[model samples]
Target: LETVGYTLVVNPKTCVVCMDRPREVAFELCGHFVCCAPCANSLGHGVTPARCPLCRADASHQRVMRRAASLHVATMADDHMHPPPPPPPRPPPPPLPRPPPLRPRARTTSLGPTPPPLPPPRP
Candidate 1:
C-alpha cells in the first residue's frame, strides 16, 4: 500500500514491531498495520502503557491479523513448521516358552525307606 506523498515500504510478512514474524496485528491507535501477535499482546494487554510504532501514541488495543492479509505479508516459507513423518510401527515380540510341570515323589512300603540299611551298623 502506497501513500500520496511518501511510501512506507516493509517486508510485509515481517512483524512491524519486531520485523521477524508475519504481520499478525494492527494497533488501533495509529493506523500502523501488522505487528506480530506477541508485540500486539504485550503492548495492548501488558502492564505497561501502550505505544504505537508509527506514531508515539497510545495503541492499547490491537487487532490480530490473519493469513488473509497475504498481500501485506512477505512470502517467506517456514520449512521448520513441517517435520518428517514418524517411523512405521514394529511387529509384536514372540511369546515366551512355557516351563515343564513338576511331579510328586513315590512312597515306599518300608519305614522311611529302611534308612539305606544303616551302613552295616558301622562294624
Candidate 2:
C-alpha cells in the first residue's frame, strides 16, 4: 500500500486600508474587509454614514465585527469560466478641413507697367 502526503497552505490577508497590518475587521452591511481594529473604529465611528472604501456602501450604521484568524482563500477559476468581454475599440479622429485654394495675384507696379525697358540701347 502507498500513502501520499499533502501540505496545507494559508495566505495572509492584508488590510486594504493600512496595507501593513492584517485585516481584522469587517463592516456588517457591505461586508467589506477593512484595516486593523484602531483604523476600523475610527472609520466606522463617524457621525455621518461612512462609505466603504471598496464599494462605497454606508458602513456607519452597520455593525463592525472582528474577523477570526482564517485563511483568505480565493480562486480565479470563475474568471476563467466567464471571462469579461473585451472593450469596444476607440473611434477614429475627425479629418482636418482643407485650407482655401491659392489664387494667382495680379502683378501691379506703382510706376505704371515700367516704360518698355528703354528700347534696347542701339550699339
Off by over 4 Å in 2: 1-12, 44-48, 61-123
TM, every model? 0.41, 0.39
lDDT of 1 by residue, 18-79 (tens): 76776666555454555677877766454668876655456776677576764342232221
Residue lDDT tens for model 2, 1-123? 123466533233555566666666665555555545666666755466576656666656444344443223111211122222355798998999999999999876676555665677788
Model 1 TM-score, 2 decimals: 0.41
How accurate locally is residue 7 in candidate 1, as Cα lDDT from 0 to 100? Answer: 70
